[model samples]
Structures are given as C-alpha cells and as structure tokens.
Target: MHELSITQSILDYSLSEAKKHGGVKIREIRLLLGPFSGIVPECIQMYMDLLAEGTIAQGVKIKATTLPLKVRCRDCGKESEITRRHIACPFCESLRLEILSSNDFIIDSLEVDTDGD
Candidate 1:
C-alpha cells in the first residue's frame, strides 16, 4: 500500500523536526484527513506501525481526525454538507453544486519529548 510510503515521508519529516529541536524524540503524530482524501484510517495506522518499526517513532502513536464533506451550490448560492445522493441544491433543487471540502490529507501536529538537560 502507498501508505507505507506515506508513513515513510511522515517519518522523514518528523525526524527533521526532531533535529531542529536537538534531536528530540517524537511522542506521537496527529493527522487531519478529509472524507474524500480516499485514505482509510486503519490502513494508515497499520502502515505507520510497520514503517515505524525501526525508527524513532517505533513506539509513537498516530492519531487521525476526520473532516466533514462540504459542498457549494452554484445555482442557489448555498454552502453545506450534502450526502443524500440527490446532489441537487437544497434551496433550488439544482444539481449545479461543486465540492468545496473533504479533499485534504494533512499532518496537523507533532508531539515530541526532549529529555531534561
């Protein structure tokens, strides 16, 4: 799965961050994933666990937050989350809405621990 590569990238980035702080070890990583990001959270976690097997994040935790799906209607000038299959605008019943949200996969934050000097 590509999540392996994804986690590898995460590790690379996290390691860079650790370096910036005098090589402090990371305690956990938090991610924000939208519904339309097309990534399964469980799969990411599984891949992360495998990819981090021999890294500083070996015992770290990966947390994910799911974002909502929001759309904007072109005809009725409405913006909201829609999931009824009938993608028409709720105000004018026009299927001219365009997706406005639920299309992001991002790393939100990192928790690191630096030993006492």
Candidate 2:
C-alpha cells in the first residue's frame, strides 16, 4: 500500500528533524490534506501510529485538516467549491472548469520537545 510509503516518508523526515535537534519527542503533527490527494487520513493515522512504535514519533498526535475542492468556471467566470469529483460545475452548469485547488498532501508542522530542563 502507498500509505506505508507515505507514512515512512513522514517518519523518515520527522526522525531526521528530531535527530538534528538531539532527539526531541514529537508531541503532535499538523497535516494539511488536499481534497484530490489519494492518501486517506484515517489510513495514514492508523499506519503511522503502528509504524511510530518505539520511534521518536511514539505517542505523537496527528491532526488532519480537510481541504475543500475549488474550481474556476470559464463560463461563469466564478470560483466555487466543488463537492464532487467531476467536471460538473453547479453554479455555471458548464463543463469548462479549471481546478484551482485540490490534490495536495503536505505536512504542515511538527511539534517536538526535548527533555524538560
């Protein structure tokens, strides 16, 4: 499953960051999900949790944010939120639409803390 790869990437990157900072314990991960991104949040969380065992990410919390699909209609010259995945534009009723946003998956931020000193 690609989710494994994604989770691995996240861990690999985060681990590097932690190591760079002398092994800080990650507290929470804030992620931004794109509407068109194929990665499922639940699947990611489940796999990440399992993969994080014994790692710096152990006990780390994951927070996912939903991203609404946005499209620009050529006919109506308007931008609107798309609920469904298709060329269907509700406001303009036109097939001529350009996707403005969607299909974006990124790790926004990671909170890590070292031993309380």
Candidate 3:
C-alpha cells in the first residue's frame, strides 16, 4: 500500500544520488526504519523490485536497520527508551509524552559502483 509510493521515492532518490556521484550501478541502499513507522521492509523490497527495472537501481540490496522507540516525558523532560506496548514515561510516570524517535523512515546511505561499465 503506502510502501509502493515510498519505495518509488527511495528508488528515485537512489538514482538521483547515483547519478550525482557518477555511479554506473547502485549496489545497495541502507535504510533506518523506525519501529512504529508502519513500513514493511519486505514490501519495500517487492515494490523496489518492480519499480527499478531497467534502471541503474536494479538489483539493489536494501539493508534496513530498525531503530528503538524513544520518548521524552512532558513533566520530567527526560528521554527514555520504551517498548511499543507500554508508552508511559518511566521517569515521571506521566501519560503525556513527546515522541523523539521510532516514527520515521530515513535513507542512511548508498553503496554504488562508480566504475564505468
């Protein structure tokens, strides 16, 4: 579903970056995936397989690293890591918390072949 459009964007960005770096082939893409970002790595790989055909981005391996969920307590203003099941702030025992991480998907880096083929 949403992974389709997101994967397309990833491919587009990868191609753009590869071209900028004078790369002839994109070998791999490193991704930082948030735990609660709702993005499935398998889905993205499937979409990328379809979308990257005939492009320099084809045959690209996606390496996704899941990030931990961290939140800041509104009362104590302290950041702590917590699981998705339990969201309460550990320091102040307050229900009000501001999410600091685990809600975003980011492209970290790319491995590309710069040699002329």
Provide the overall lDDT of each model, using Cα atoms, as 2-decimal numbers.
0.76, 0.81, 0.88
Q: 112 in model 1: Cα distance from truth in Å?
A: 0.8
Candidate 3 residue lDDT tens string, 78-102: 9998776777888778988888874
- Minimum summed lDDT over a 10-residue window in model 3 is located at 95-104
Stretches of candidate 2 off by over 4 Å are 21-23, 85-90, 115-117
List the lowest-lDDT window of 10 residues for candidate 1.
81-90
Q: After best superposition, candidate 3 residue 6: deviation in angstroms?
A: 0.1
Q: For each candidate, what TM-score against the reference?
A: 0.78, 0.78, 0.88
Candidate 1 wrongly placed segments (more than 4 Å): 82-94
Clashes of each: 0, 1, 0
Q: In lDDT terms, how accurate is model 1?
A: 0.76
- Candidates in descending lDDT order: 3, 2, 1
Is 1 or 3 the stronger prediction by TM-score? 3
Ranking by TM-score: 3, 2, 1
Model 3: how far residue 106 lies from native, Å: 0.6
